[model samples]
Target chain A: MSAIATPLAREPVLSLRGVNKRFGAVQALTDVHIDVAAGEVVALVGDNGAGKSTLVKVIAGVYQPDSGDIRFSGINVTVGGPGEAQALGIATVFQDLALCDNLDVVANLFLGREDLAGGLLNEVKMEKEAWRLLRTLSAKIPSVRIPIAALSGGQRQTVAIARSLVGDPKVVMLDEPTAALGVAQTAEVLNMIERLREHGLGVILISHNMADVQAVADRIVVLRLGRNAAEFRVEEATTDQLVAAITGASDNVVAARAERRRTDGAEAQLEEGNSDG
Target chain B: MADTEQTHTVADDLADERLIRVQGLSGLVHMTWNRLRSGELGSLPVVVGLVVISILFYAMEPRFLSSRSLVSITQFAAPIGIIALGIVLVLLLGQIDLSVGSVSGLAAAGMAVLVVRHGYSELVGIMAALTVGLLIGAVYAVLHNRLGVPSFVFSLAGLLGFQGLLLYVLGRQGTINLPSGSFLVEFTRFKFVTGLTSYVLVLAVVAVFLATQLWGIRTRTRAGLSAPGQGAVLIKVGLLAVGLLVLTWYVNLDRGWSYLWLFFVFLVVVMDLLLRRTRWGRHVFAVGGNEEAARRSGVKVGRIYFTVFASCSMLAAVGGLLAAGLQTSVSQASGTTDTNLTAIAAAVIGGTSLFGGRGSAYSAMLGIIVLQAIQSGLNMVGVDSSVRFMVTGGVLLLAVAIDSVSRRARSSSGRG
Candidate 1:
């Protein structure tokens, strides 16, 4: 059930408050608070091992937060396990995609949730549903019966994202869905993210590609050293600002040394644009 | 295929989904070529290997392909074939039951002792032996789930421990002869379907296969989903019928078709259906393919592992019982000598991937036959166990190497 009483739809679909996680001596995440409203796309960006994945896992219920209150639809809920997280209408497409290569597209699409008729797999119905899902995304898969091993990276990603829809979740978290994808495939995935937004579902996109993030994300949340570094409105934030936040360039020794050069570089870019005009 | 969408009457826009149904003979051929080029070998390698090996063996020894030789070879494959089915299921999950050989032997030993020494009826003794298998499986599952002991280690322990238990139960005799008039012995030894019955059964199989295929096409087509054409269905059903009839005729040429071997094949077929056409089978492949993914998807990983391990042991028990029935006795070497290697080798050779989530139940049948043929042919050529063991091991390696190489070829070709 969603909180639909508010006409403005400003209430966050999912909100994390002071969440913290530790793996022994290493604090993977700390005091991480992020919120997403319905129909909003939130981009999570971080360098390698900045705890973006750890935070995603916590939200997805793969790892329970050490101390935090996770509120979904303005209600506090305990994410004890992935099952509970899924039951709470949060669907996650992890970084690995997690598809069985030996199984065909239909099998992969309906892995845990298969429709059975008379105690046997209703392949006909499932296959039909599979085609419908693929068509909705305009996915160009050749066949639904071929094993997942035969699918391209884009098709596999589509299958994983489409599988998440089988549950019709409110919050959809995609962990680097465009990683290792070609240009066209990346565009296809971006279109899917926009589609999720159009469907009035909260979309969480975790990515390393700044171009992809700035292209589709409404708001970007950057993580640095297990903490929230900065948040930016996509319309106003410059690439340099995003990069500065990601690399913590404000106080970095090398970044400070290049600060005057950065200003000069910006003026030089304006002169170049003037000459071009 | 896209053109067909337009040509075909529009029943529902929702049902008008795209399927790569290549029409005409050439298009079908083109599709198959694409699959083969991508390393979707399926039973191709086994069929080719069977032919090559059969020819080479026949050239070396004229009696290699004789009907009588084939009969004995098939009989030899029955028990291991049944055992290999369990291996296929376990391998699909990327797990193993190293204790299967010992488990089977223990079951036979237990059955013989209870029936011959304690004078229990054969049925009760057999059930008791199978129940022991179930309990042993549960123990393995518990050790795996609760103690965090890996299946390989636990089954390794079971292998040694079960073999010791078998020896201890025999109590210095080390062997027990099954009763001659016992139903178990008699049934396994002389039970064969008459040729008439076998042909009828083959017809029934063909009929059911065709009916299902037609029904599937009808359902999908009616639902506005793309379905295989009637032409393709007929072709597939035709090939299957011809293959079954040829196999039935070949086996019947000997001592008719053994009902026991049919039973083994039946189990494999049923398991194939369960693995391919049921939700549980999909879960098995999912859990085996990626345990973490399966868990995140809400699949009960522990339960899947438990059921596979338990069913594997149960099948091993039945395989052991069949072996005992074949010899009419349980001995120290009943499950000892070559059963373990042969059964595992059969599975691998039949194109089942050792890496898991990539095997079929029917591979058990194909792989076992190839293995038994090698052993039988080597016997005909006066090759001793030294050569037999070496050859079998070499063949297993070859199969695995081929599997890996083809997998690489597939990846390089951008199939994944």
Candidate 2:
């Protein structure tokens, strides 16, 4: 039991410092610094092109940072591809999830890493393990034998999460985990993330839903114009303050008011054009 | 109050136990029905098509369903069926292998040159043929995987290249007849039992294999593993039994039965096991489903592509060898256009989804039978060869269109 760290107060499990990524002429990410401690959930929020995806891609090994360094477990690491990241116990569940819906839940969970015995796939072992994993996450489905196509969006998300944990990954990054789920399903997925944190795994969550971030995120890192704008502890910030920080108007009340005035002016012009037409 | 409490406790216990029993039972039933409805149970359309064709052929000529005709059909279907099995794998991965017909021709030519011209042993000739097929397949796979070429183009090139090689090998010798020998005559010509008995033997083998598979699945489920529902298993076995029984009955109608069809079925089963039970097989499925995802998952995607191409070529070679054995001769005109088109059509018609990641070897066998039946039926009805080609082409188009449409629907529904 001592071998497993508690879900609080630990060294940074993964840290990215001064990371920058440029694609051709445009810089997708700039000077991004984020750290996820053991058992901590870090929510990364930004506008449409705020580099949320680029940042996650860098950590997931989809893109290599042109500058800055990545440190995992206090050791500087070079991640060439997703495989390398996986080897380092970093699992990223993208929006697509990369699951074969034609296959049953167990088959999807053990897609490439099926258990083998006597030179044959040990279906029994794989099935049992799948069951155990689901049980641990407290994912309730009718049966684990059903194809993923038959599952709801929430269940499918659960399956993807289970697949990521198959190798017992240290860092689990989920992109819009509840974006397609209903109210109940969103709650279920949030609960699962809480459970993952309780197990002492560092979680990086990318979401547009402020409510979700406030509910689950321990630390909220706001990105504005491809750079870190502000970092807030959930207890120290209100919804208005977070929104202000994201919109780049947290420091000046007059600027925030002016920006609102400009938005209203644009809306009035659109309405005037509609009436004239 | 104590009596009331005891009654309440008893009711609660009964309800709990009943719920467990009911869940288990419903799970089994639900799974079985699902399997039955899915194309996994062997598409009903294919089965009905075969039956309808058989009846029509029988009506045209009473002897068409006789023992001799049945034997002939099996012998014809054997080589084609073997090739179709390989096509099934390619199809399951959502690809095509157009080189099989030419690969088969090249293999037969190679075998003939080795054994008859080079004065090599029959075993050496067969080995040479198989090796050549495998090498050709490997090259195609590499080109597709490493170079990122579509399988269709890679195999199309193989088709042309191998066919040219076959013509080159034959040279001035337009035909080569295999020498009649004990091994050749016994294995190719001998019948283990007469008429109905032979069909029974074939059916028995199929039943045993299916039973073993079902038992294995059950044990996995009982061990708390995630296995397809018992209902699905039963439905699968039931469909297989019905199919084999019908085929046997048809062949047994005549007093003579050929073991050639059984051999073809065996080949299909072996290929199925290779794809389902082996690491190589899983890799092929993965590569087909999403090559990028599979590569990210640490699979040697390039190697799998290469291996699958090689396997298809090898199967093509085996088909050619069997065809030569049945005819006792390899001719210049052997393995014409029908060979390639029919094999692809058979795989698609048999329920090997053109979209990949969801098909079986048995589908190939069903597809082959359907195509052959169409050819044979049309000929018996006095339809010209030209018209037959057009009909087959149309059917192939329809099958492909349906497959693609269904795949799109499934994906859009967020099922895939």
Candidate 3:
């Protein structure tokens, strides 16, 4: 719970204000503002190179923001590195998942923070914990002992998401988790995200799939050309509005196609009426 | 609520109906067969190679299977096997240390010079040599981490430079004989754990293995996970006990098993434990499997590289010292010629993948035996060193080819 009084009614579990990041001549991110309250899923939708990844990296401590403030539970903190970010209860599952394919699921889940008993890895304990974690997420991994390479893409996604929860983080960020997954797998991931929210975690989901975002997110935050374009509650946000925000123009390809189809349908109707007369 | 409760019940079993459940010895056999089909070969190919070689050699020259010949093979294998053990570490990282042979020669040469020429105690000389190994590894790490030099290029450079250093360290003498009375000479050349002591050692190994297996079973059962049957554990332990006893009896017919061989096995076992049972070991495999992923997961990739290189060089140094002690001398020729290739070959033939992240310490043990057995067999069949060299090279090529093929199979089978 947040201790300090703020301008807002209830303090968000994670909040970013006016964040900016520059990579040499390219301003990767500019004036980005985001807030994720506990039990909320905030979908970050953007086109390629739209600073969605850059923002996630900044929060994950892979990159430092040139300017802006990050407040975690009303406390200002600097995440020096990935380890520091984890220590701060901010866990991120990168797009690549960052898993060792040669290792088993249990090993991947407890890679850096292995439980040791008498200076040796306690396999039983780790396996038990892995089972418990997967159960919580409702992951359908057959066996935790199987190497990650043997698992399906959906299973791998489950393992990655499960790994994030190993730290018991207040915030979980997933970058394009369903980008390389199948339809069923993507559905599984969306369900996993819902489970993450139900567990009262503030989730930041970065995805390009409008359907996935609309299905899982409590709110949608659109980024276009490294800047925040628009924000809307999922209940009220239409696909067209979200797409326009993502493409940064109402006359983008998708909109143009739809507009052309509408006109074509009207012309067809007019021709049918003329023929009947 | 009913659906959720049903899912909870499924969770309690730790496996969904969709998962194939293997139970008992039959299940184990079936699973192994599936794994083989999927190209998760493990040490199967190497073990088969060993058996085939033994039968072929025994057919060509009955003397090759004699107790005396076996004893000699074990002795000759230990030094290079120890070096190969280090190479296994580097290989696990999907990196090679070309300088291992040179490092061994240089370290041994340095030790001999210190002990014989500089009038240093044998212990001091040994420690100094190992220190040189550690220092060389650290320097290589700096070049790799800070300068971004690839492991092969710098190690290749070390290969020539250290060999020259070895020759220079030997100076005008070109060779230095280890004193006959020194502990290093005695341990490497003459010591043995024979008679009752050897049997006790075998019993100890079997006992420890059984205890660990039983412990695992108890803990797994308590955690509600499927445990391997007690019958399976007993069968494994029984087989191991019989094999060790037979080997010991055979070796006893000769001058008995050399302490040097024992030492090498001890190192292998210790290394295997470290690689499989410790955090450092886990990180090593992770770094080898995918360096980028390891880095993203917060693994200290640089440090892991450093430690593996350092340990590899140090093990090479140990191998060098043992070789020196066994021969009772260090010469300019020591650790030269095919030494590096031989060590690397031993690792590969032992079923360690050249691609890294898929090997173990036991690979060194098994690989060296295959090699030395070949050498002994070739000699018994009256083949020259020339034939030996070609045969060894051919075997190495075969091993690498198998590795490549299996890797492809693994990927295709979704087990890569």
Tell me the whole-model lDDT of each prediction, alpha carbons only.
Answer: 0.86, 0.78, 0.90
- Which whole-number lDDT from 0 to 100 does residue B246 have in model 1? 87
Docking class of 1: acceptable
If both were scored by TM-score, which would come out higher, candidate 2 or candidate 3?
3
Residue B153 Cα positional deviation in candidate 2, in Å, after optimal superposition: 2.7
Q: Provide backbone clash counts, one per model.
A: 1, 7, 0
C-alpha lDDT of residue A271 in model 2 = 100
Worst 10 residues of 1 chain B by lDDT: B10-19
Ranking by DockQ: 3, 1, 2
Greater TM-score among 1 and 2 belongs to 1
DockQ per candidate, 2 decimals:
0.42, 0.28, 0.64
For each candidate, give its TM-score against the true structure.
0.89, 0.83, 0.96
Interface RMSD of 1: 3.5
Reference-based TM-score, model 2:
0.83
Which docking class does model 3 fall in? medium
What tens digits encode model 3's per-residue C-alpha lDDT throughout A144-258? 8878998999999999999999989999999989999999999898999999999999999998889999999988888889998888888878899888888878889999999
RMSD score of candidate 1 (Å): 4.5
Query: In TM-score terms, which candidate is top?
Result: 3
- Model 2 regions more than 4 Å off: A1-8, A18-31, A66-69, A250-277, B1-41, B182-186, B189-218, B225-259, B378-384, B394-416
Cα error, candidate 2, residue B46 (Å): 1.0
